[model samples]
Target: MPATFLHRFVLSIGFLSLFHSAYSAAQHRSYLRLNELDFTHLPLDIIIQALISLFVIMYGVMNVAGDFKEIKASAELENKSWETFRNIPSFYTFSHRGKFLAFPHQTGNKKHN
Candidate 1:
């Protein structure tokens, strides 16, 4: 579906706000608030860089959490701790104490083979 002209204009405004808002504040590395990590330093570039790095780290963590462990453990447990995301099993499996989803096809027994 195509968006209306109003929607496009709104999106443009939102993107423009980033540069405008950053430019308005002569003080660099300044944020409305600071967290434990942002202590002491108040430079705009530093703060922005830190925020970007944090976002990348968080994104990587979320991506890693999505899959890997489930498929590996499918051979040993009845229910894999790593879940199937959109039908794609995990790429790796972790070692747990008898807690996992076992694959019936590989293991004749309902429990870990």
Candidate 2:
């Protein structure tokens, strides 16, 4: 049921069929048609092409996966910052003075004095 297992099985079957047709000969077939080749008898060119294609496809997928991971982590950090800010009422004020924070009394309410 796994994708990898299915892929392997399909490749095996394809290779077997390719070679089977190449070397096996039918009873009524001529010399050219009777010839049957084995699955492992594939030409080097085909193997090289397969390898090149696999490399390119795998590389592209891995690159995309890495980028997705980075974006997901950044989103998580942003959400956490937002959550803390929501729970802390005094977290929003920012000033260039000696104190970067302000207390409730700093609101200039005379009742607190």
Candidate 3:
């Protein structure tokens, strides 16, 4: 779905609220430092404001992104040609453990009986 005016408005409000909360926390910390007070927990109201703003931002973003399409493997490969599945020579590997069974005597390691 296209991003409506309401969505943009909500997103803007959320961002503003989040910024305000962050600024308020910073100011609170500064105030405590100026008075030489111990650093303690943030006020409940600021925490609540931040959480609510985060939820609002999430809601606004989901609405603005539009609906997701269903993905199907069969549908994806439907138009592909058979020639695309053919083996490529550059990808071939001739070096493997099978060579040991085929030419054990040729190997330098002697068997201990």
Estimate TM-scores for all models. Answer: 0.24, 0.29, 0.63
Find the number of clashing residue pairs for candidate 1. 14
**Clashes per model (N, Cα, C within 3 A):** 14, 9, 1
What's the candidate order when arranged by decreasing TM-score?
Answer: 3, 2, 1
Q: What alpha-carbon RMSD in Å does predicted model 3 have with respect to the real structure? A: 9.5
Greater TM-score among 1 and 2 belongs to 2
Best by TM-score: 3
Q: What is candidate 1's lDDT per residue for 2-104, written digit by digit as tens?
A: 4455545544554454445456443433344443244364567645744554555454444444544446654555555545444554655466655556543
Itemize residue pairs with steric clashes in candidate 2.
19-37, 19-38, 22-35, 22-36, 22-37, 23-36, 23-37, 24-36, 25-34
lDDT of each: 0.50, 0.50, 0.89
Expressed as tens digits, the lDDT of each residue in 1-113 for candidate 2 is: 22354455555555555454444433223443456533334455545555555555554444433444455657566657566756876665566564536553444545643
Q: Model 2 shows how many backbone clashes?
A: 9
Model 1 TM: 0.24
Candidate 3 has its poorest 10 consecutive residues by lDDT at 102-111
Worst 10 residues of 2 by lDDT: 23-32
Query: Candidate 3, residue 42: CA error in Å?
Result: 0.3
Candidate 3 per-residue lDDT over residues 1-113, each given as its tens digit: 89999998999999999999999999999999999999879999999999999999999988888886658768766887888668668888899778778744655777789
